[model samples]
Target: MAVRKLEHVGIMVKDLDQSIPFYTEVVGLKHQYTMTHTNGIIRLAFLAGADAQESQLELVEGYEGELAVEGRTHHTAFTVDDVEAEFARIKQLGVPLRDTEITTLPNGARYFFFYGPDGEFLEMFQPAPGR
Candidate 1:
């Protein structure tokens, strides 16, 4: 069968403890469960939004540092309702942003990037209509 939807997005973090709160509070994702890799010193935490149909956010820890030298990109962006409001809320938390302004899409979506507590890049945005 063909793919129906994206299942989840995986993020690599330096520490789960530091990254978890931002996902739960700022991004507002709910923790589902965690798993410890049998063959490595890695941990995985899967989180979901209120709408279960959407994909989950998986946080991977312990596979970072100097060993992870390649392949991991900067960050990933997820859909949001009001990017401006979300920016205001997160800015109030005093998290130093990697960039201080919002990026605009050709279709009018507003967005920006910031680092999570674990220093992982995270992008949030509000999409334009028909986008």
Candidate 2:
């Protein structure tokens, strides 16, 4: 089967109260809606950027401590026009970055990683021209 675009990235957060504001205000995402699972074991808050059709960021709750493996979940990357400017903005916001310098992948994509409110890894990428 052919894979379509990504639907959403599920992230487990300690508290939805704080995570919601961070994603909306800091990350510049729009809050769509929230809903709990049928079994009531988890609650999810879906968020989207200006383009609602793009992939979404799902803030998940009630599953803390269960998935604590680093590098396993890895990161979720968002495309940007200028990686440097975005890096500066994130720094100006007092967010800690994974590295002091941006790295260019073999495919010529520049990116940097940072930790989220719940210690999840997040990345910002800028692909090469014509990519």
Candidate 3:
């Protein structure tokens, strides 16, 4: 019918191995799979929520040198049903990531940040429905 759900978030990471734990431990998610499309062109890792589906995090590594620096972008925030646990877990990780200065959104959504090898804002927010 319509769109099933979010597929995955594509991130450009300087290193794949380094960002694994952040998604695994900090976010309390699992690495669904990893792949290399070419010898030194494209590499990726996919992460999914522990209790949910239809959405995943894609960590793309191996875009080295300056070719990967063209129009770089920022991190993304995934909506969650619970903010306390999400915010706490990310802070507990101690990963080098920046966010909206601090967690807690205007709509009472809570969030935090963590970098993926390269310094970028990876945000996670939990919002109450019917807001």
Candidate 4:
């Protein structure tokens, strides 16, 4: 069977309250909804883009262990109008950045990496205009 589309990316976070603001305020995603498991062991918050068609970011709370190393590379990137402006905004927030400066590709795609409260890597990308 072929996959249709990516619905969302799940991230196990330590605290939903702390993580939720970052995606909503910094990443510019809207909080769609939140739910608690029947067992009360897990709580999830769903954040989505302004365009409903875009995939969402799910934040899962109640996990106790360290995030997997693979999680760092398994990052989710959000498209931005300007990578430089986003980078400057993140810098102003005093967030920890994986890259000291933004990087550009031959195709004119620009990006930079940063970490979340749980050390989860996140990227902001700007594709070449008119492409």
TM-score of each model, in listed order: 0.47, 0.51, 0.46, 0.50
Tens digits of lDDT, candidate 3, 19-89:
88887988788987777643447676778888655567778787653434654433465665655665556
lDDT score, residue 15, model 2? 87
Supply candidate 4's per-residue lDDT for 21: 95
Q: Report the Cα lDDT for candidate 2.
A: 0.74
lDDT of 1: 0.69
Question: Model 1, 7-126: lDDT tens per residue?
Answer: 456677878998888889999989877767543587868788987557778787876535354734435666677777767777988976876888764446567777798887676756
Tens digits of per-residue lDDT for model 4, 1-131: 12234545668787999999998999999998777744468786878899766777878788555655666224567777777888999999999999999876544667788999997767786755664
Q: For candidate 3, report its TM-score.
A: 0.46
> 4 in model 4: Cα distance from truth in Å?
1.6
Task: Score candidate 2 by TM-score against the native.
Answer: 0.51
**Candidate 3, after superposition: displacement of residue 25 in Å?**
1.2
Q: Which of the two, 1 or 2, has more lDDT?
A: 2
Scanning candidate 4 in windows of ten residues, the lowest lDDT window is 1-10
lDDT of each: 0.69, 0.74, 0.61, 0.74
